[model samples]
Target: WDSVIDGNTSMEQFLNIALINAPLEKDYTILGQVLGNLQQAKNYLDLMAPMHASYNSKISKALSQMSLRMSMESYRNRDFQRRWFDAYISLSSHGEALKHIQSLLQSKSHIKGLSIDQDLRWAMIRQLNRYDYGDAQALLAQEKHLDQSDSGEKAAIAAEAIRPQSALKRQWLNTIENNDTMPFSKIRIAMFNLYPAEQKLLSAATAEQRFANLPLMDDKGPVFMRSFAAALIPTQCSAGNINAISDVLDTQTGLSQLARRALLETRQEEQRCVKIKLLLQ
Candidate 1:
């Protein structure tokens, strides 16, 4: 009955209830009573459907930007993306919802206070990647400060995140570090500030150097911490491509085999390199 009343229940719950009870009710009046309950529940749902839509719509707007910023955190994850997908798929016009989140994340409060929680940041990053570089760069700049400040703890965070220099990580970090004309520090500082205290300091150094320089100093080798660091380091040199890459990495669907193939194919294209060059050019 709750399943019939609450739209939020998963399909599994519905099936489990039907399987357990459908056979037990053999009397006609009992069956009719169940049918009446179902009809009444349906009426309630019909009344509340619009309200659900409105609620999710509001959540989607807040989440989209929050999720984008979250994607840049040391804790972006698939579960966060799944929630965002749920909110997004329910909307009739997602554009307003997306921009609302983006605006909040990019607002002064999110950048300065790091109030955009992990789940919300994950949602926004998924949305931010759909736009062009200018938009993505704007998003990264919000949290770049978190990536630059390198205290002892910050260095520890970097060691965990950037230690294993994948070929892609090495390439991207090298490009950003040496790009004197673009003032990588300014750009990355903006990114770091978007993070909470420790993360803001850690991400800066990790984002700056080539992967070769990022080995951990021993004591912080937990699997998830290291995996998170490696994955969060931008794979593309330009903020734009990096943001797009972030979008792909931010969501479960975005990380699908097809998405990986697209990213790999993109990496193979030298034109993308030229486009990155043009950010400074």
Candidate 2:
């Protein structure tokens, strides 16, 4: 109580004690006091001057470190809630993580100024395919269009801006909460796994065929296929052809991974069969 009111104690020490003893061993009603102390400390540090120029640099660095520590501590607390949603999905065979993210997106308050990281956005979208979050879906589609239209880093950033959250997201959440009678989990897993590869393959094949038919057909077929290949081929693969396929395989849902592994196994078996045939011959 003395430390809370005195403003001499570090925020870390106060928060640590509150975490351990708050509403448990003690009434723990000092949150506002701690925040006020922290704000005051920040203001003081901002205005304080060190004796030497070198010391001023050191002081600024230390203040930055302290601010980073506080931000990390806050993130840790937020992380606990995210982990609960992740576990709910894992155990219940529904997409709780997706729904939670969708809810965040739907509420401008939650997503405001929250620069969703790229990998996080991808994971959220991938999960959305498993469930429903209609707003998220529309945003993602717009994001995809923007990505397709832009080039270079701007394109990548545009792609990362939209994420998956669909109406199906809440349905999956409900299924998980209600113990998964719907069993759409398996179906969701399969679709997410299969679609990326199929989409890539379809685009590649279409472009190639279009290019081939351009020479054979009359009505500006040559121009059409040439432009089609130019415009469409680039987005189909992130890297080269092989890397794109591998990326899709690597990022697939669990069921997709299983299918990919099985396909690889079968291909290996076929190679072995060919070698055996050659040896016998």
Candidate 3:
């Protein structure tokens, strides 16, 4: 494998070596280790388009056999299950991947008091969204333990609610407003796009106004600046607040290059719109 990665050995030669040294017995541990190594190799090969599909068959076979041998207890671990699911999804279509995930979800017993892995849960949510939004909402409704305090879970739930077919937009807005731990600027921006009037109403209800009283350029950290810049630029453009947009463009301390570019584009577009309006008049 090292020789293959280092370009000393061809992939075909590496495959031949792997096949020749294959153990006769069905050892799950060894299979798991090999699967990990193959996954790494696949990542490297992904950069070369011609060689991308070469490892698909081997990876799929390993995942199938590993799934069969591994117990439900083993699958309860997030890292273990994520590796398997990610590999499976990479090789299979969305429908096939969802079918396999649903089978695993159905087979596991919550009576063991083990929590469902968050990655598995999020994967199901995402796949279900692709497959059926109604079914995804139903599943979300059934999940009683979704903690709003956990930023990841909150983000996932927010993502689900923002989907076009979701009817829980208002619920998600409330959840985002109440989440005091993480910055809500990103979520607010999403909500603003989808339900501007409702987002404005929610923003008014909250004491901390959206993107209005952000920390000064020197005071804020990178994360805060990024989130604020991401949220502010879009909102200002949409609201036709060109002055606010220019202010963001003038500030040099915290905004990322991407943010600056977006603001510049937005300002130019706004000016173009104004010129078009004047010409019409």
lDDT (tens digit, per residue) of candidate 2 on 1-281: 35433434443454446434422322123533433443433222222222123433443344333333333334434443233223222112123434555664445325222345544444545445433344545656655564453232332332222222233333332232233343333323322232122133333443333223322322323433233222222122122433443443455433233344443443443343233223222
lDDT of 1: 0.37
* Local lDDT at 155 for model 2: 28
What is the C-alpha lDDT profile of model 3 across 82-139, one tens digit per residue? Answer: 4444445333323544565555555643313234466556555544543443356666
> Please, what are the lDDT tens digits per residue for candidate 1 over residues 1-281?
55433334542344346435633554545644543443332222222233334543443344343433433341344443333233332221256554555665566233322345644453354334323212644454444445454432332232222222245333444443344464433324322322221122333445444223223211223332233233333333234545554454454342334334444454333233333233212
List the candidates ranked by TM-score, beginning with the highest.
Answer: 3, 2, 1
Better of 1 and 2 by TM-score: 2
Count of clashing residue pairs in every prediction: 35, 11, 0
lDDT (C-alpha, whole model) for all candidates: 0.37, 0.35, 0.45
| Winner by TM-score between candidate 3 and candidate 2 | 3
TM-score of 3: 0.37
Provide the global lDDT of candidate 3 against the true structure.
0.45
